[model samples]
Each structure stands twice: as C-alpha cells, then as structure tokens.
Target: MTNFVTKESLFELQSITNPVLAPNEQEALFIRTQMNEKENNYNAHLFHIELASGHLTQWTFGNERISSPAWSPNGKLVAFLVKRGEKQQLYLLNSRGGEAQELTTLPNGVNSFLWSPCGEKIWLTTSVKEGLAITDEEEKEDKKFPKAYVVDKMKYKADSLGLLPQNRHAQIAVVELSSKEVTAYTDAPYSHSLQGISHDGKTLVVAVNRVDNTDDVFRTPLYLVDVDTKEEIMLIEEDGYYGDAAFSFDDRYIAFGGSDQTFKNATHGHVYIYDTQSKNRQKLTEMFDVPVGDYAVGDTQQAASAPTVMWTENNDLYFQVSTEGDVRLYYATLEGAIYPASPENEHVYGYAIFKNGNRALMTVSNPTFPGELFDFDITTGERKQLTTFNAEFLANTTLSTPEAIVYPTKDGFTVHGWIMKPANYIAGEKYPLIVEVHGGPHTLYANTFFHEMQLLAAQGYGVLYVNPRGSHGYSQSFVDAVRGDYGGGDYEDIMAGLDYALANYDWIDEARLGLTGGSYGGFMTNWAVGHTTRFKAAVTQRSISNWISFNGVSDIGYYFTEWQMLADMNNVEKLWHHSPLKYAANVETPLLILHSERDFRCPIEQAEQLYITLKRMGKEVAFVRFPESDHNLSRTGIPSLRVERLAQITGWFIKYL
Candidate 1:
C-alpha cells in the first residue's frame, strides 16, 4: 500500500536532532524525538551509535525527554539535561552502562552546560536573585494580596519566559565533577552565558548583555575569566550579540560567531578569530556571503542553534552556512579560503566535528528524508548514514521531491525557489497551486523536508515556496533590501515568482492559485490579497495587519517595526503605508486567519483587526484562534492543535482553490 503524507502522518514522523560527536570520534550521541499518539505528547530520548560498527543503542527511557547531551573529554561519561519535577537538571551516566545519577541540584535549575576541556569540571548557567529579593513563599503571599507590579525597566517582559523576574538574572557557575564542589563566578544584576573553556582550563569565556538600557542598543560583550584568579577581562569589545566562543586546541586563538546589528535581527552572522598572542582580531569569513547558520524556519523540528566554530588541527574552521535554502558545512582557512565541505542539496541542522576536523558527526536531512546522523569524512568527502530511527515509517510513505528554480523578479534581480508538484504528477495535467512564504522575512525556505508542503502535495496541490529578497541565505543587500521597502521589492519578487511559475510550468493551473504563510509570510499573504486578486484564497497564520496596533501589541513589535520598517509612531504615515490593513478595502479574496492567542511576536489581535475589518466590509473572512498557544504554535505547540491547524489550512484551500 502506498500511503501519502497527511495531517495524521505527522504523528508517525520522527526527528533526529542535536548530534554530539564523542571525544574519541568512534561513536556519536543524539536525540531521537517521536510523537506519542495516544498521549498527544512528544518524547525525546538519548540514543548512541557506533560510527564504525553501525550499531545503535537507546540509552534513556520512560518518557523523561532528555536534551543537550555533552560527552566528557575522557569519553567515559555522558551528561544530559532533563526536566525533573519543575526544573531542568543535569544527570550523568557511565558509557559502559548504568542508571544515570543526578549531578546538580541548583535552586534555579540549569539552563545550559558545557564540560571543561580537562573534563574535570562543568560550567553551567542558572538564574539567581540580582538584588535583595523576597522568598518564594513571600512572593506567593504578595501575589495573594493582589499587589501591583511596579513597572521600572523598559525591557522587562519577554515572550517565552512570560513576566520577567523582578530580581533574578542568569548567572554562571562551575562544578567540579570529582568533589561535587560548586563555585559561582557571577552574581547579581548581570546575566552571563558560558561559551567555552580554554585548552589548559585556565580561562573560561562568557557572553553578557551588560548594556545599561537594553532598549537603546543591542550589545552582547564577550568576557574571559581567569579560573584561578576569578578576574574577568572584556575581550571582543566591539560586538553585537557575540557568543559561541571556543579556544583552539593549542589555545592560540579564540573563534566565535556574531553580527554588528547592521540590520538588527535581520543581520547576517559572521565568524571571527581573535589572536590571544597578538591581542588582535581578524574576520575569517568576511568574504562568505551566506549567513553562518541553519536559519531556515520550519515547524517540523525544533530550531537548532547555529553550529559554532569548530577548529581543525591546522587552524581551519569548520562551520555551517545557510545558502540557497540548504544549511551546508563549509571549511574556511585563516588565509581567506572557503569552500563547501558537505555535498549539495543537503541540510546539516546540527554537527559536531573532531579536533582533527577530518571526521564529523552531523544530522543531515533533505526534501525526501526526515533527518539522521551521518558519519562524514571531510577530507575524502564521504558520508555514512549512522541512524535509521525513521527508516521503517519513511519506507512506507510516498514523498515529493522539489525542483530547484531560479526566476527573474520584475526588478531585474533573480529569486530562488522550489516547487513540488502533486504526487504521481503527470505531464500537461493542470493542478491547483499553493504559494508558501516563509516567516522571519529574514529566514530561508530551504531544501529541507516540510510536513505541510508534503501533506498539501498528497492532496494533489502543487506547492511553490521561495526565498524572497528579505530572506537570508542571499547577499546582504538582497536581505536588507526588504527592510524599509517592505511590500515593494519583496512583494514583486513573490508575484514575479508566481508569474514565472504559471508561465513556465504547464502543470500548474493558473486559475486555481492559493496563498498561505505564517509570521512574516502571513504578513505577506495579507499584503498579497489586498494588492492583487490573483490568489483566489489566502490563509494567514500569526500575521501582522495593522502596524499602528502591532507596534504597541507585539513583544518585539516596537523595536522590530523601527529596525525592520525604519518607522515608529513618529512616522505613522510610512507605517500605515506598509500596513496591509491600510488597503483592507481593496481585498476581495476569501481569507482564513489562523493565529495563537498567546503569540507575542505576531499577536492574535493582528488577526482580529484584519478579520473584523474584512467582516465589516462584507468580505469573505474566517478567524481561528488557538488556545494556550504561542508564537511557535506551528513548530512546538500542542500536538493536537498542530494537527488541527494543518487540517484547517488544507481544508480552506481545498474548499476554495
């Protein structure tokens, strides 16, 4: 029986992420996540694989969901994080086999941890009180009394963490493995993130956002602390959100990744090397055009942090880059030589490279595959698939492969996109087409498998997804081009791509065009319908409609509007000019507004305002509000809700398009 992807098929899909290469390079550890259909929950377990023997072992069990596995330098023990009771804690187990032992019992719980180079100690991050704070019991009593929270800090509240703790700030601490002794390096009024330790274990690097008024500028400075003296020195003084620092094997140089906030959140990250001997810094990837990350946004898997700089024996850097919708590995030398180390059309979500750099363990996926660990030999350019967690499920499923496309936009610049025809596609058969725009306007729609696209194709719809001018993985000018211009260039790029597809591909039905997107893509969808009537129907998820209300509503709206649009309340005219709601009177297409109630990035109100206006005008529009969901509802929200959201999207297009 040949079964195609569906909303229910999401339950059968498994994701292999966070591949960690052991120090010996003989084995690898990774997280294999699967959805529990009956429970409607996700369960992640630690899995180990021998690179040479191809043998796999499930190391954890009982649905405790583990992540961030770190192997000791000696390769004898593995440390992983898991939520126990109410807090995330660290546990360690011997490689030979044994029950994991609780390592740390910090009051604030562990946020992130890294093993020291010598393997004798561990550096961890935890939030602690910054000032004289009331006890938890007292705080609860105060809440019972209904006292108002006096607002002081301009940048107080956040999305995921909810209301910011009045007194707590993330601090760094080091724990000795042998004696179980803990030492606090930072306390009070400052939050610190442990980057990495030096080879000799004498210095530990940390990143701190010490700006007095964070609302003014985005700045994260790097600091090197002497382990023995407990003295900190600001290294990498000129920076914007710099971290992920790693010392070379010989401790000659420290390499890290960051950007100068040229475009704020839309800025491309670059890798740099700081010479400890000469006390000077040099940019190794100044010429590399692509951003150093797997910045392609997707709902199927958790967004993996960008791979940090990995050092080779000869001081070459093995890092990841988002280029043309694929997150591939690239090797860069100090002398300005850079080239791809991974093969084409494969997305390396996360990777761990050995000090020798000749071998690496990475989680690789593509349009036809979910994801799996691969033992890669950099010098020989070979890869051996190490895990088959989803082989059985995928073997029974029919998938669609996308065709790479390059179409000219109206402005003379080129746009890159991918098109997936209906399953069992036939020549000269006109099929309904669905155009997908990605979020992050800065994020890429990459060569990775997307569940929604596959599901739509299963229903006999051709899906067209593209990286417009605002998307990453392109030239800086191309990404920044969307900023300030907003609907001008990016809108034309999308419309031009659609025009090219309809003109070039005979299998696409020009009369049955549909549009759907989430976040920034949602914004574009709203803009598309108001500007053009080509799309018969459009589905917008977590979209922004009215910039006037969005600036005050969204968590990042105030700064994001100013940074991305170059407009604020002061420039209401420009803001309104770019707002889709400003042109709501022109909309005629049936619109499906999907949003989460708790989406702080693109709040549900954005949907409400658009939905209400369309309804008042007697236009065709429907709104669906997901309960207890956040901005990441599509990606990491409730399993049942995710299925429902997909069903609604597929149903909307099927009923209209």
Candidate 2:
C-alpha cells in the first residue's frame, strides 16, 4: 500500500449501502461490497450492525451478489435477494442467527422485494415472459438453439439490459414464507413494481405506467391496489414520475416522489402526500428548489439503492435531497413544512430512517472516504461513524480534499465547482491543471469521493471539476439552459470556470492544461478540444461525436436527442450544428479517446467515428477500446478494466502535460 492513490486503491475501497433498519431499532442490516482483486470481481455480503454499541457482524459470505434485504416487522427474520443460480431468488434468514433458506423459484429473477407489515408474505417484482420457461432448468434448449430476438417495441433496448426479451413484462409475485410456495399475482402487460404496502397488508402501491407510447417521459402512474379484492385506484392522474411510494404506518397517508414534467428532465421531483381516506393529494415541497434522492455521480459505491420515500411514526415523510454538492436527509410533514435532519456537505447515499424518525443509519461519504455506515441522530444532528470498512484505505491513502470554488459565468449566473490540489503540493510550485466535467448534463458533481479525480491529483495534477449550467443540484432553469445549446453557453460556462480557477489560484500552470469528461462530459471534452487549443491534452470517455448517427445508434438516442436538443432527425442541421464532429478539424490538442465496446448510451461507434476521422486527418489522437463494458465502464465496469482506464487517462495527461 502507498500513501498516494494508485490503481490499487480502487480495490481497497469498500462501500456500505442499502441499509435496512431492524424493527427493534437496536440493529440494522446493510450490504457491504468490496472489489476483490484476487478474483477480479465484486463481492457483496449481508452485514448486521448493533446501533447501540456500533458492533458490525457479517451474515453472509462468498462472491455472491446479495441485494434488497428486508427485515420483518418483528425483527425475527430477514429476507434478501441472492443469485446462486441463473436468476436472483428470495432467501430468508433468522435475524438472531441461521443459514439463509432459498424461498422462491420463479421464471425470471426478482427485480425488487418488500416485506408486508404482517411479515406473513413477501411481495416481489419479477419478469414474466409469455414464451419463456417457468424455471432455469427448462432453458437449456434456448442456449443451444439461440432464437432470434424480436424487436417490436421502440423501447426494447437499454444501456445495461441490452435488447429486452420479447413479450416480457415486469409482473408481481408473492412468496409464502411458511410454506415456501410462491404465488403469481396480477399479470400486467406493462411493469408492475411493488413500491410499498399498507400496515394492514390489505393494500399495496405499485409503480406502473399504462401509457400508449413508451417513448414519452414522466408518464408513470402509481396504482394503489387492494391486495385481497384486486381493486385498483390510480394515485396520480397526471402524467408524471410518482414511482417511489410509501404508506404511512396507520394507512392514513401515502407519500411519493414525482414531477409533472413541467421542465422535462430538468424538473425537480417533488414530494406528495395522498390521503387514503379523503382521496385527496397534497403536493409538498412544491417550492423546494432541489430534486429528491442522491443524484451525485461517483464510482466508489456499489449496490447503492435509494431508500423508498417513507413516513415516520409521527406521519412525517422523510427523504433525501440533492442540493448544491451534498445529499442530506430531509423530512416534510403533511402540513408541508420541511427541515433538514442530517449534516451538510456530505453524500448520504443510503439510509434507513427509524420508526421514531429521530434517528437514522446513514451511509456517508466525502472526498477522502468511501461510503461507511453511521448512526445519525436526526433531531440532535449528531452522528457517530459505525463502520471501519475503509480503514485501510483511510490509513494508507494521502488524498487531496477539494476546495469549493464559485465563479460567475459569461452570463449573469454563478457557477459552482471545486479545485483539488496535487497530493504533494507545494505553496509556490505551479502544477498542471486538469478540468474534469461530469456527464448527465442533468447530474451535478458532488463533494463525494471520486476515484479518478483522486488518481489525477495523486499524479501531480490540480484537478478542477465544475457543475456547469444544465447540471442538477442547481435551479431547474440552470439545468434546462443547456437543453438546445449543447456547445453554446454550457461550453462557455466550463471555460469561464477554468478562467476563474486560473485567475484566482496562482499555483496552477497557465499553459499546461488538460480537459476530460465522460458521456455528456465526454462530448464536452471533444467539443472543448475542437473549439479551442487552450488545453495541451484531453481525454474523452464514452463520448458522443455525431448526434445525427447517435440519434439512431444509441439505446436512448431517439428520445434523448429530442429531450436534450428539443428536435429530431428533421433538425439534422441543428444536430450537426451542435455536434463535436462538426469542429473536429479544428482540434490541435493531442486527444485520447476512451470508449467501451458494449456501451449503448453513447455507443462505441461514436468513438470509432472520431478516432477514424482524427486518424484520417493525421491528428494526434489515440483510441482505447474496452471490451464487455457499457457506458459505466469507468465506474462499475470490470475492475481490471477500471484500473486500465485510470492508467490510460493519467498516462496521457502525463505524456502531453
């Protein structure tokens, strides 16, 4: 182990996520994940923690992929999803102690699971394909014959899932824990996800979008279904995203997260409360400026699932909010009053709010730390670190903590960013600067642990990353500003951020500058090198070069282009006008293109086109292609490949800068 961060530091990192607070309030269960270098894979296990003494205990072992752990109401038994076979199946274990028993045998793997209030049964979401066999034992012939995949739906393909199976829909199932028998509930053509259930277990809320065209965004309609009578009631009639739902303990209120698409993808998800008896819904947090949940983008976490929008025992709803550069816990009442419950300037990626609502078990991380569990007293705003999973990483690494920076954009708006000096920094020594941009255009760069940024800093470079216009964690207008102006103001904001950093800090080398980003950030990196020669070198990862071809090739291109550009193929002129390929000839910086072979978000063809075009022009460009990786190659791809990706980026910058 070395003091400075290296490729090996990624393997030493451990992430604790998906916290399930036990019913007794004295203990909690969470998934602890670590990158195992020996096997070159990720290993996940169920871990239990005593809240009072902060004693953590591992419940499961091996290289198993465990997820969605739910504790029974009595805290006597715990259930989770694990994949010991072809698909993930439900498994139950005693909370006190016991081997987990496999509980479900379904045609498709379970997507999500939730324990009913009574704990008599477990409701789950699993795929149901018409022509598929009922068990994994019956699918041997399909592997041998390999039938052709039918593509009749416009939304058939996705980034990670690839082309979806034909006639397959996410349906519901229930496992009778005592008898170990599973029952197929209502079969739906569309997806029917189990969101939350009432205390009485007589009703369940499910996430389902019964729309004609799947291309439309924010058309989700949650349904409150009667479990016994099979009756359905539409929770929200408006076309919006109301997926994350939870029923109050008394069944008096149902709270959910949604937005009416008033600002398209930029709209902040608001919290809503539906009165079960009155049949009236109240929109809370309507004036809240930030979105709900942890939208911070980073690679140091694994299996980090968002907590369902839930209610406290006092009927106050609690949720996480992405604001500025942090994700903090916040609770809102049915009266619409909201208040922060956790500390500021950290990423609360996962947490379990206690029934009393005054305490919580949070997985917190900062720039220097991977995620770890902490017992947080919400009312008192006190927190005690409960896990030392990354103790080795903490002791061995000399990481550079980011200094928050704010500067005015070309326009009137002020931009937020950070500057991390080199790990071995001297007061007067000028170092090379690398301006890193985040993708999503809708996602913001939070003040959480970023492995690549740390790697760059450790390599003797000042890493400056910014949340330019169109990045979330800001105002809706700021995020929507770059919708049609890809390279217009957004690009200017990035440059202005660079200019501010250089002007304000004397330790940064003015001439030796590098640029980098992925996805939208990758597109920007390409755009920056093409439009200006300010940077001596640049690296573009999982980028978009030509929007025209991207409109058809990318998994989400068809609707995404229209969503981001506000136009389609009919506006080829506009697409080309904003594409980085249009200005590739002007590129003078030696650029390194890194793309995943199986990436469907931007697709590998985009990188191929750029690399080929740059090679044809005899430009100083090199392309590194990673196999079996999608758009998340840098984050959750193969561990060896992730290491290689870091090496390529740092090596390129070291060579040119």
Candidate 3:
C-alpha cells in the first residue's frame, strides 16, 4: 500500500543531470538538484559516485544552486559553475583533497566553458557589452538617476533573460590556468557559443549569428577559428541551421546536428558528419523521420541541454531522439546505421560514455519514477540502477502510470497520447476527467514524470493528454500542421481524442468533463471552451487568447507571429479570426485563467483580455495572477507558490466539475 502523491511531493522529487565519466572510468560526477520547501527555493550541489562500488558522495554544501560539473582529463581535478556573486563564476576543486576555489573572476561572469584536451587551459563563453571593460573594475557608486531602456533592434528582450543589455553579445574568451590570465577570443559584435575544442586545443568550433540584422530571423552557423592566428572559416555553406559540433579524437571528422529548414522551425533535425580534410559533409541520419535531439518536454526535467552529437573512437556517433512520446538514446555509425543504445521504455535525459568503451552512465526517468542515474552496458544490454534519489518518495507515494493510446482524428490522422486513471482509482466507479493539453505546439509530452499531472491523478481526476497534430515526436508534416491553422485541425484532433477516450473508457464521466493546459495548451483550452459546451470547466495557464495582441506583445512576437500565424500587422483580420477571444461570447463553460506576471512568452495580458471579456459579459470566469513568476512558473517557480498554483487548479475543478 502506498500514500497518495500530494502537491507537496514537489519537494520530495530530486533530479540528476550532466553525468560525466571520470578519466579513470571508475567514477562519474553529476549535479543533483532538489527543492528546499522551508525557504521556498532550491539548492543544487555537486555529487559523484564510485561506479564500481556504487558509493555516492556530495562534494559541495550550501543553500545555492550548482550546475555543469566536469572532470579534468586526468580526473585529478573538477570544475563547476556556481553563483556566489552577481553572476555565475567558475569554481575549481582538486581531487587530491582541497576545498573548491573560485576560478574565473569575470565581471559579466561565464556562460559556459570547455576543458582543454591537455587540461592546461579552459575555454570560456561569456556575455560582453560594448563600451565596457572585461576585467572587474572598482565600482564607482553612481549618483541615483532615472534611466530609460532604448532599443533599435527587434530582439530587444527575451522571456527569461529579460531586456537584452544594449550592444551585449555572448562572446568567447580563453583562460590560461598557470597564469590565470584571460584572453578575449572573438569580438565580432555577435553572440558566440563554444561548440567543440579540437583534440590539440589549437582549433575551436563556435556557433554564432554573424549575419547583419539577424534579430528578425533565427539562424546560427558553426565556424572554425585558429586559437593563435584568430583566423576564422565557415564550416557549413548555405546554412539553414547547425550546431552541437564535436571533433573526432584524430580531428579527422566533425559530427554535428543540422536542419536545412525544409519546413522552417518545424523541420525535422538530422545528424551530419563533416570531413575536416575534405570540408565536405554527409547527412548520416537524413532518412530518419524524427528530430535529431531530445525534444521531450516535462515539468520535472530541468536544464536538459539541446541534443548533441558525441563521437567515440570508432566511426560511431551517439545522440538522443524523441519518438511517439519517448526519448531514447540512439547511435549511428559513419556509414549511417542507427540503432538504440540505451534501454527502451524510459527517457535517457543525460548520458556519459566511459573511455573504456564498454559502459555508460544514463540519467533515466519515466512516469512512475522521478529520475535517477543508471549504469548501462552498451554491448550486453545489461544495466544497474546507480542512484536512488526518488526511491523513498516512490515507496511512499501512490503514483499513477499512464496507459498509452492512439485514436483516429476526423481528418484520418492517428493521434497518440496517454490516459492516467486516478491514483486511488476504484473499479466500476465513474470519475471526473481532465483533458491535459501540452504547450509548445512543437515540444512533446513524452514518457516522463510530471508532478502536476500526478497531482491531478492523486486528486481522483482521470487525466487525458495527447500529442495533437502540432506536437513533436511525430512527422514534420504532423508537427507543421498547426502552422497558419491555429485552432483549425489541431483543435479537431484534440476533441476527437477526447471523444475516443469517452467511448472506450467507461470509467470517465462524460458529463463532468474538464479541460486544461499551459502556453499552447492554454490557448487550446481557451479555444475549446469558446467553441464547445462539452467541457463543464477549463483552466488556461500562461496562455494566449488574442493573437493580434500576442503578435505584438510577446518576446518572440516580431518573427514568431509571422512564422506560426503566417500573418503580421498587415493581416490583422486573419490573426483575429484565429484568436480564441473572437469566440468568447459563445463560451458557456466556467473558466479559470492562470498567468505569470513576468511572462513575456505569452504575456499576462492575454489572460487579462480573456478575463475582462468574460467578466464584462457576466460569464462564469475567474483569473489568478502568479507573482514573481515567468512562463516557467509551473516547473521552476517558487516551491510554495507552485503548490498554491496546483491547489488553485484542483480546487477550481472540484468546484465546477
């Protein structure tokens, strides 16, 4: 017997990330992040394990967050990032036994870094603002004065990064370990991210948007720069999109992820290998149907990096792919033979291969489990559970396992999704159902643990979540279907999925149906209520209601509006027609609108518009505003507030459904 998972289970969950194999191949280092309920914050620290003995140990202690822990070439030292100052600074620790010491002292701090092949120097990626010094200068307290932010570019602000500092770019810098001297590498007035450092550390591959006025477009190409000469050469010609580059041990070939933008952002990503000598590239997974990276979306998984191509001594490259609501590890040979590397039925969010060539450490998670580290044998398919971060919680909580299902849509499309019954489900008892739609319209709801969904299940509500036409883990045509159509076919796909569930599952009460989602899903929830009277209640989180206003107010409004809606200020008629606000008068279902005050992605204004319209018409509608939260409030918001937010949702459904 197990206890029902409550909203407070948020603190019980712990996530593991960035597992790197030690040089000796007998140990692995990783970052473990968990919540501190009393402080309503989170604490992250470095942790390592002796792979052979399965002994776990924590390296750092504090009420602070830690990330990106890496081992030196000889495994005698460790370097990690922490925010002890105004910005995150690099910290180094000696494996020979010494307290961690702060390494780089940049005023703007570091974005990311790569360990040199010889471990003698480290490559630093940092943010640089023009008309400013790189070194820390004595701060002269400025006289209190009012200032106004001014911008001439379309990319003036981002969702999480907030307003972009004028003339600032992500640039590359180098640090000499012996001298502790820092050298600025690229100063092209464009953002540059260190992709791969050559085996000899003489050549570096960096991804940057060097084109003029790229603020209106999204594109980054890789370029090779000589360490000493500062000579740069473009790696890909006619680049649509490419990155995640890594050089082979012999520097013979470079493997990376690329997309020709066949369908723009909806294009399927593929793996490619470029010959350093020939300067020619080969599309290794050109025939693969899915995207090249882990496109799986979940609330529990945090800071999972974009998919990358990892090269081994052999002609093999390892990568992860999202397919049919599952993210798994797959490897492809130079000859283009792709096969599964890790186990099936679980999400491998992170992995590190040992130099010994026989084993790998995998960070795996699924619906029943929060996440943990696992030791996997590549050749024999043998595996061992390495970490039990969520074992006690698992044993204590009665979590619901989702049952996968596929139903036919009105347009002859097969929609894939999962149905989770209540945790304390009773046989032959009818339960109110809540239809969960995912955001992104591009990202996927895969086989991963989600605290919010489990909370709904534990509250005795059957949950239905499906990947409609606009979701990832499907074909390019499927993912691209929602483009320019908005509430058209994608809306039909969701309603049809719900109808199929009602017809197949007698345990779900049709009369007491409810609907909810965030971001894109929130938009769908708003659309569903306005168009149909089937749902008795609905909750929209950080959602969009008016496309016309969203296209101008959102952070990505400048380009994303045209890319998805295929309409800009020039076509206000089309934008308004697709907006859920246009159908607000027809809404009969009681609605709850949840939004973040600081959300620039969808903007809180969207929620305000819908709330005002419904309230003016004397309709059953309510709005809840989350303070000090962005678009990610549900996942990475204040721990106490996250619980309160869930209480609002379950409470709303309980009152109406």
Best of the candidates, lDDT: 2
Clashing pairs in 2: none
* Local error of candidate 3 at residue 440 (angstroms): 0.4
Query: How high is the CA lDDT of each candidate model?
Result: 0.85, 0.86, 0.85
lDDT of 2 by residue, 436-554 (tens): 99999899899799998998999999999989889888777887899999999999999998888989999999899999999999999999999999999999999999999999999
TM for every model, in the order presented, reads 0.96, 0.97, 0.97
lDDT tens string, model 1, 479-529? 888989888999999888898898889999888999999999999999999
TM-score, prediction 3 = 0.97
Please say which candidate is ahead in lDDT: 2 or 3. Answer: 2
- Candidate 3 segments exceeding 4 Å error: 138-143, 237-239, 356-358
For 470-506, candidate 3 gives per-residue lDDT tens digits of: 8887887799989999899999998888888999999
Once superposed on the true structure, which residue ranges of model 2 sit more than 4 Å away at CA? 131-144, 211-213, 216-218
Clashes of each: 0, 0, 0
Output the worst ten-in-a-row residue range by lDDT, candidate 1: 132-141
**Residue 296 displacement (Å), model 1:** 1.3
